[model samples]
Target: MQAVHTAATAPAPRFALRSSELPIGVVAEQLGLTLRAIRHYEEMGLIACGRGPKNVRTLGQSARARLAAIADLKALGLPISEIADLLGPDGACPDRLKARLRAQLEALDARRSAIAGYLSGL
Candidate 1:
């Protein structure tokens, strides 16, 4: 079966895989991730993949969405732990996600201001 694209409202950018399963190399390429990074994320349990023929790691639709969310959240400065909580078994709570994101934005704002101030003094 061909993999279906995850809904836009599914919480993150979801790319499609030609088939129900895709090799690690293809996933890494499409997601702009490295094979090692993909493996690392798997090791961290941030996402899960399955074993395909020849034992190559294969990522399915759900797994792709999860990895995409992990990458997007990480880019936004969310740690893996927070991401796990956000995507936990109960699924995402809008309130919780908003609060955490708000905090991260505030922290980033402070850091940017500090850097600007430091640069001005130079």
Candidate 2:
């Protein structure tokens, strides 16, 4: 069955995949992600790919969204385990996600302060 593209399901203009059930390589190319990285995410249970004709791995719309979300979380310095939890079946509670982001911000602030202190001494 073909997935419908709603505003939410539609890929971002910045990084769009052409179709549902695209080959893993196509998805990687479209998203500017490496094949190994996609495979790793699959191995980590973060995304699941289906086997298309001739047993080729294919990523559907949902998997693409998960991959994008995973990249966003990774960019924000979230550990994979934490990301997994956030993206789990519960579908990312806003309060929990906010708390995690707040923690990350606090950690960054602390690091920045320490760096400034060291610079002052130098």
Candidate 3:
């Protein structure tokens, strides 16, 4: 006799999310970031999020780490465009970044030297 299958006997579909992966809402709350900002980052290609069950956005470990780095860069006053270029598709800082960093460092040193000179003269 053929075996009978019923709804009760059918296996429930499951979303195969790894333990390290989190939905966007959970990630935003955990990271102390607003959902809008997280979504903006997603749209900017700064962090890649995978589609979870029911099309929910899920961020894996690397994407979460990237978001943390993005937050740090934002805190350091780096613009989104520059951050995007710095963390581009290759996921490595390009050679031009070294030049940009040097330029920024030189400007900062110049400002610091000027401030010190003013303080010394006063």
Error of 2 at 25 (Å): 0.8
Pairwise TM-score winner, candidates 2 and 3: 3
TM-score winner between 1 and 3, please give it. 3
The alpha-carbon RMSD values of the candidates against the true structure, listed in the order shown, are 11.4, 10.6, 4.8
- Which residue ranges in model 3 land beyond 4 Å of their true spot? 1-13, 29-32, 53-55
Estimate, for each residue in 1-122, the C-alpha lDDT of model 2 and write its tens digit. Answer: 99899998888665444466788888898878899999999998889988766667789888888888888888888888888777765334467777888988999999999999999999
Candidate with the greatest TM-score versus the true structure: 3
Better candidate by lDDT, 1 or 2: 2
Q: What is the lDDT of residue 100 in candidate 2?
A: 86
| Every model's TM-score | 0.66, 0.69, 0.71
- The whole-model C-alpha lDDT of candidate 3 against the native structure comes to 0.82
lDDT of each: 0.79, 0.82, 0.82
Q: Weakest 10 consecutive residues, lDDT, candidate 2?
A: 12-21
lDDT of 1 at 70: 75
